[model samples]
Target chain A: MELPAQTFQVTRADLVRYAGASGDFNPIHWSDRVATKVGLPGVIAHGMFTMALVGRAVTEWAGSPDAVVEYGVRFTRPVVVPDDDQGTEIEVTARVREVTEDGLTRLEVTATCLGEKVLSQARATIRTAR
Target chain B: MPLDPSFVGRTYPPTAPYQVGREKIREFASAIGATDPAHHDPEAARALGHPDVVAPPTFPVIVTMAASSQIIEDPALGVDYSRLVHGDQRFAYTRPVVAGDELVCTNTIEDVSTRGGHGFLTTRTDVSTVGGEPVVAVWARYVIRGEA
Candidate 1:
């Protein structure tokens, strides 16, 4: 079954806070000058930040914060933040792939920004009964 | 320059212990907009059987990123930090990390290869408690873009 999609807003301020919280001080995340110099269109969200938002969606679906047994994702594209109040939106959706007799549920996840896939091969296994 | 394939299977010494503080967990969760009660309230976490507030799934990167410096900074390994971008990430948890746990990471070079003039390096980090209890294993792949 297809799960309801969750959307998140990413802004420059959010990136700054994430950098401090996550200890990733790469200038490309905060400085558009640095980003453009690096040949990026503009500032982009950290791949891990996008993954964390997806993780939030997964845990919310599983009804427990500690339910994840395994999670993985490949960074396919950058989620560019326009340095404005509106920033960008990331939409996360997932589907049930399998459920084990041992109570594990596997989900295939998709995360998109501006209609472009940001992460591919995204999957998570959770202990649904725990 | 391509990463040396010989670095594969090489393991770095365990990093110094990192204290997982409740506020740090709360900060990380809030940064990602994760407002689960288990991540913010110690009482709520304890009610859920965790010793204290639990970390969000990707929180361990904070520790591993620092620990992995051992390899990225290895003079012999020769990683160009400026050109590196994250390619993929994975985590397998034995249990949720709780606040007050002192964690150590042992980093190992899992793979190294080059294709299309781009170098790929994959690192695996074994996270365990200071007392040696296994906690989680994390894998991260970084792509070093070919020099222009």
Candidate 2:
């Protein structure tokens, strides 16, 4: 039930594409002025978008998209995507908390934005193909 | 502008049932880059005791968001979709959502208020099977920023 640790990098372009595909055109996600006007420090990625990435990390580890049975997360902090050359990176590490008698594997997930936890108490239960 | 308190306890009609499909689950998982086998393989899901491939917990968003359209389109509710921003969301699950389940959602406006010049609205949606088995409850908050 041990899961491999995984990490991912999210760029402004990724945010833009996610916004388009998800039909969430909120300017704060892509426009600095709109972000600042909303009293945010700068552009922030969509929380759902980040959660989706976390979901991907887990599914990728399982080796197929359909292996997950349940997943949830709480947005603890905003992922402030800097407009600088460095952009932003999210590192996600997942460990198997338990494997139930029914074969449901519970995972404890941690996602960091520049080494600080952006999403906390993330977890998923996936029915493994095995 | 004050919201109608009468709407607070009102529950909307149940949305038409959405039949969960393997292809849609795979598409959603792939779009999010979830490579979990239980999300895609029925044999894998059955190995884990589920009747079929089960969806990731957050997958309920697909159904509940559609249910929210009822409130968004309510003229008396006064929701400005253009000005609205997703504030927050959380889910409590009674059971996992698996493929082939015909599910319906009932949405209720839990609360509405204006604070710090921002309009805040909270809605709760209950998702269940066509047979009336409860699956999950989703709570979402939306914020409408004040005009400059």
Candidate 3:
């Protein structure tokens, strides 16, 4: 079974806020100069920020804030956020891979930016809803 | 420089206990635009059976990042921070992290492999309560890029 895709919008401002809240003040995530210096296209979203959005999607789908038992992802590409009102969007979707007898549901997930996959081998396990 | 493969199976001493704070969790949730009440309100979280505001699933990265830095920055480990990129991340939780919990981490080098001049370093962080109750185990992989 497939879950509804969730889209998240990210902006330069969001990156700054996340940098403060997460304490990851990496220049690549905030300064275009640094990102470009590192050969990145531009300021890129932190990989953990993308993972957190995916986690939000999972918890929303599970109907419980505390339902996730496991979550994982491989960062294949960076989500570059431009310095503009219309920054970028991340679309996340998932498929039910398995539902175990022990009340766990495993989901295979994908996250994309600009129609390119940003995350791979993404998966999450949540407690089966009663 | 490629990380030392011999570091696999090596474990670091436990980190100092980290107190999971309600305001910190809220700040993180808000920063990510997560407005879920369970992540903010103790009453809302209690309604869901959690003792206090529940941390979003990826929040453990806050602790593990500091804890794992002990290994990634170890001079003997030979990890080049400037050339490293996150390759993978994972977390397995016994329960949602809540406010007022003091968590500690023990980091272990799970794998180190070199391919095509790129170095892959995998680390596992075992997180538990100061009282010794397990909470979460986090794994992170970093790729050390070779010079172009």
The numbered model that scores best in lDDT is 1
lDDT of 3 by residue, A1-130 (tens): 9999999999999899999999899999999999999899999999999999989999999988899999999999999999999999999999999999999999999999999999999999999765
Question: For all candidates listed, what's the TM-score of chain B alone?
Answer: 0.97, 0.96, 0.97
Q: B104 in model 1: Cα distance from truth in Å?
A: 0.4
Per prediction, fnat is 0.89, 0.21, 0.94
True lDDT of residue A111, candidate 1:
96
lDDT of 3 at A79: 95
lDDT by residue for model 2 (B23-89), tens: 7776666556556688788998898788988777567787887789899789988877767777767
User: Residue B63 lDDT in model 1?
Assistant: 94
The Cα local distance difference test for each model comes to 0.95, 0.79, 0.94
What ranking emerges by TM-score with the best candidate at the front?
1, 3, 2
- Where model 3 places Cα greater than 4 Å from the true spot, the runs are none
Full ranking by lDDT:
1, 3, 2
lDDT of 3 at B10: 96
